[model samples]
Target: MKALEPIDRTQRAQVVALTGKYIEQASRIFLRHFVMLPVFFDLSGRLAGMYKVHGRTRCIRYNPWLFARYYEENLAVTVPHEVSHYLTDTIHGRRGIRPHGKEWREIMALFGADDQVIADFDLSGIPGRSYQTEDYRCACRSHRLTHIRHNRIRRGWRYYCKSCNTELRR
Candidate 1:
C-alpha cells in the first residue's frame, strides 16, 4: 500500500452538492413531504451508505473511501442510492419496513436507475487500502487481512477456510 492520502475536501463538497440535488428531486416529485437531510462521511468499507433517523431528523452516513475510489459512480449512483433510502424511510417513518422494499425500488426507478447500473462500482482494481494488512495462512491458502479483521481474530475469534475446514494461522 502507498502513503495514506489526505481527505479530498473537493470530492466531499461534490458529494454534499449532489446529495442536495437528489433531495431536491425527491421533494419536487413523489415524496411531497420529503426534506433535505444531513450527510456525513466516514472511512467505512462494508457499505456505500446508510440512512439513519434520530427522532424527527434524518441523516445519511456514507463511506468517503467509496466516493474517492469511484468518484463519478459515487456521485451519480451512490449518492442517489442513499437518497432513495432517505426518501423511503421518511415516507414510512420507522414502521419496520425493509430497506430496499418495493417503495424504495420505485424511487430508484425515478432516478433512472433500474436494478442494473451502468457505472462500474466494482472494486477489483482498487488497490488494498493505505492501512496495513496482517498475513495469515490456512492449510489451503494464504490471506492478508485488514486491521479490523485482525483485531477480531485477536479477540479469540477464529476463521475457518471453507475449502479446507481448517483454522487460519496468524
Candidate 2:
C-alpha cells in the first residue's frame, strides 16, 4: 500500500467547488436558501466526511487522508453524503429524524447520489487514531475497554460480559 499524503491545493479546491455545486443543487431543489457551510479537511481516521454542529456553529469536515486515497469516490459519494446531512438538518432540524432516515434519503435521492451510509474502503495505509484501553474483569474473562467506554463506566454506565453475564469491573 502507498503511504498516505495530503491532498494538494488543486484537489482541495475541487472539493470545495464540488461542495458548493451540491449545496446549490439542494437549494434549488428545496427552494430555500441553504447557506454555504464552511468546509474543513481536518478530520482523520476511517470517516470520509461529517456534518457537524457545535452550538450555533456548523461545518462539514472531511478526512484528508481518505480523500487523497479515494479521490473520485469521495468527490462523487462522500461530498453528497455530507451535503445531504447538512440539507436534512436545514430542513428537518435534526431532532425528529435519524441520521440516514427518510429525510436524509429524500435529499440524497434529490441529489441523485447513492444512499449507502458508509463507504467500503481498505484502510491499510490511512492514518487512524488509537485509543488507550483499560482492563476489566468479569466472571469468565477479562475485557479491554477504550477510554470512551472507560469514562462512561466511571460515569455510572455498566458493561456486561456476554459469556459470563456479569458486570465488568476495574
For model 1, how does the per-residue alpha-carbon lDDT over 5-73 read when each residue is reduced to its tens digit? 423888788788888887888778864756667778864654666777777777888777666666776
Show the lowest summed lDDT stretch of 10 residues, model 1. 116-125
TM-score, cand. 1:
0.63
Taken over the whole model, the C-alpha lDDT of each candidate is 0.74, 0.92
TM-score of each: 0.63, 0.84
State how far residue 143 of model 1 sits from its true place (Å).
Answer: 17
lDDT of 1: 0.74
Error of 2 at 19 (Å): 0.5
Best by lDDT: 2
